[model samples]
Target: MAEYSLRAASEARELIVKLHNSCLTHINEVTSSLKEEFEHTLHLESDLGQWLDVLKGRVESPQLNSAHRDFGLSLYAAASGLYRQAFSSSRSSLEVFIATTYLSASEFKRRQWVSGKLDISWSYITSAENGIYSQAFIGEFCPAAQSDRDEFVSLAKATYRRCSEYIHGNVATSQLLPTSIAYDKEIMREWISLSRTTLLVTLHCFMIRYFTELDFGQQRKVEATLEDNLAHLVSVRRILDLPVERSDS
Candidate 1:
């Protein structure tokens, strides 16, 4: 077993707390700006206007249904040394964000899926064989993600594996339960870094897709706001040494 250091653990908890606050602040700022824009430019009758409504609904769903709220609670859990729960919650949030991104790309598909007329499953959405990995989906829906497809898939798969161990009560996770409540510094660091990067990238992709459907004037306004907030998110990715290129607009 790896030795645990109290001092190191405390520092890691502090770092996680700081990162959590920074991420939440940026997310709120972006969401608020988008909401303000939507209210100012209402157009419920048009196709693009209806699409924005759907985007607004999905972005707000995370908070309304507690998915985003759980992320914040997970950070508190990590700060209290509940690393297992924290990791699990992070993965859950990523899953929701991914689904939301997929849905945001198409109003007809999302409506069908939500109304229970579509026969798709979560596995199908994330599947390597016929899901987001297929070129058709990437090209037609989320071309921006194609820029760093390899990195995105690698990170998602690796983190999903690690989180599954904790969620399923696997032997690897059980072994850690008997140890000190405090998590290893490196493990906590990795979880926070991975979770933040996944969230920011997902949000950026969603925003980019939404922007593409807007007229030039509205697009410029939204893009300006996004680029301003994106600079800070990119800095966080750089500090974690994850993938700064993934943040490119």
Candidate 2:
């Protein structure tokens, strides 16, 4: 009996050691090979900081704070090769972010949410009829995103569902995600691409809700990112009033 227990303990220690080594190896691979993709997402974090820093007082909602922190956590998880955790966190951030804007119009609703009285409605937030991305809802706050309503809404819904796949461990994802910690270029590529998409979607939603409220100086804080990431769209150029560099006319 004693010998068996000792052998079991040794095997357990070996498994633990193997797991840590796998994690370390995967981290090295991600940081080295995916440097460009990872840094691109980091840039979004910088843009987010500037946007929040300028209006920290007004945007002090707990949900937004949680969402921002989750975005960072998602990046960390991705680097650590925890793919499921990374996707889950990113999806959560998406939910809270859009929910923040959904709750913005009503202080009472916001307060109720803060006090645990109101629940965020994902269906309503993404409702094709009147949700945040709907023509009517967006036209009220952000005309720039209005023209591209279907595009943003579709991207948002698709990404949300994709992340849920990892979370729910659906049949396809079950086969995709390895049973143990390991580096997978394909999955890593998928995640990096998803991260950028999530960042862009969130940025659009954020700008839709609050960008115009910023003074020109404050807007300039995030202008570079918007231009770099969003300038291809004529609607964005129109909203920012950039020069007619393109022959959209």
Candidate 3:
């Protein structure tokens, strides 16, 4: 018998456990370096989770649930140095949230989606003409914010393409990844930035889709995140109804 042939299965199991233990230790070692990202990670989780908590019956869907679940998984994957998987999961969650917003406008299309008859086209979702970020969509939902559509359309497109680079394993992305799991602060920081971008884009869609319809209490629940991330946007400022200057009357 070959010296290690019979024990291949056992060796594999041991290797898996060893890798898992190494990831845990790496997580500890990198905590200080990732302070900002870790803080933002916690904040993003809370923003999405709390927003859902307040949505309870208003916007219920298996897709939304799954999207939120995947967002959480992305954070865990990042902590474990599964950077590629982390970005992929984040992109999927972002896609689902945008898709949910798009489908909320039409039950027929939504049913088609649920039945797998219609597809979730990222191009359609971000299209400058008919997408969630389009002036037409915003005009219908919250016309006060129509002027800002192009900005978010750009953001949505850029963030999605950034994640897709990782998902498709372009030459540069492949070269950037490690052969084995190990903490990569540069990539981890980038993931954190992408996570924020994902949240910002998703929240922008939700603001147009659901904000006006939310009861004052519901609006109050998500306002902090909305303000913190998007207060600079003319559209978001309008949605939040921040005070306007009147030159002291």
Candidate 4:
């Protein structure tokens, strides 16, 4: 009985040692992952800074007007880069990492299954859209007031949700969210088309109301309604331009 008890004690010690070793291994892996992330973020920020420096030069070039189209594309890229980092930075939690990885892999598999296309590059679409919106004109029209900036940011968040839904092959014809006023010009092609048509009519009605010289309270109401309704009108216009059919294949 004493020998059997000694044998059990030996086995217990071995298990404890094994557990300690496993814990060490886990700690090392987590440390390595954090280091890698730190280095990656540092490199990303450095690259973004370089892009900003180049943009500053591009902004001052005498031929800027002639190159405005290309300039616009570059600006979008820069903004997208900054946004990518910003978005991913907030997702430092383990759940976010797991969720993003699983979602990305699932989406990739779905794309392959649907189209038989296996070499899809997700970054290309992401970076291209970002580059397009990063232009000089966008900077010129950026809201200066804190309240306006906050509203624009909210709109931007909503627009991003719409874009994500469309990109993910999930949005139904009737479900797309409204486009926000805060979007860069490069992102507004569909809205631009609507603005040239139905949207212009709405704007004309609002302009007449504003310029007609109503009483103070009436003018305030008109102004408030114009501010609130403008985004809705633009979104509706954008909705008109989106394809009605879902492209699963």
My TM-score estimates for the predictions, one after another, are 0.55, 0.88, 0.91, 0.19
Q: In model 1, what is the error at residue 90, expressed in angstroms?
A: 1.0
**Per-residue alpha-carbon lDDT of model 3 for 32-146, expressed as tens digits?**
7887678877887778776777666844467788888888898888888888889899989999989987888888898889889998799987787888877788888878778
lDDT string for model 2 (100-207, tens) is 877786788888888898787778889999678887778888876777788888888998999999999799897998777888888989988887887888778877
* lDDT (C-alpha) at residue 226 in model 3: 83
Candidate 4 has its poorest 10 consecutive residues by lDDT at: 91-100
Q: Pick by lDDT: which candidate is best?
A: 2
Question: What order do candidates take by lDDT, descending?
Answer: 2, 3, 1, 4
Residue 89 Cα positional deviation in candidate 1, in Å, after optimal superposition: 1.2
Better of 1 and 2 by lDDT: 2
Worst 10 residues of 3 by lDDT: 240-249
Q: Pairs clashing in candidate 3?
A: none
* 3 or 4, greater by TM-score: 3
Better of 2 and 4 by TM-score: 2
lDDT of 3 at 89: 94
Query: How big is the positional error of residue 217 in model 3, measured in Å on the Cα after superposition?
Result: 1.8
Name the runs in model 3 displaced over 4 angstroms: 1-6, 245-249
Which sections of candidate 4 miss by over 4 Å? 1-55, 58-144, 171-249
Model 1 worst lDDT window (10 residues): 40-49
Candidate 1 vs candidate 4, lDDT winner: 1
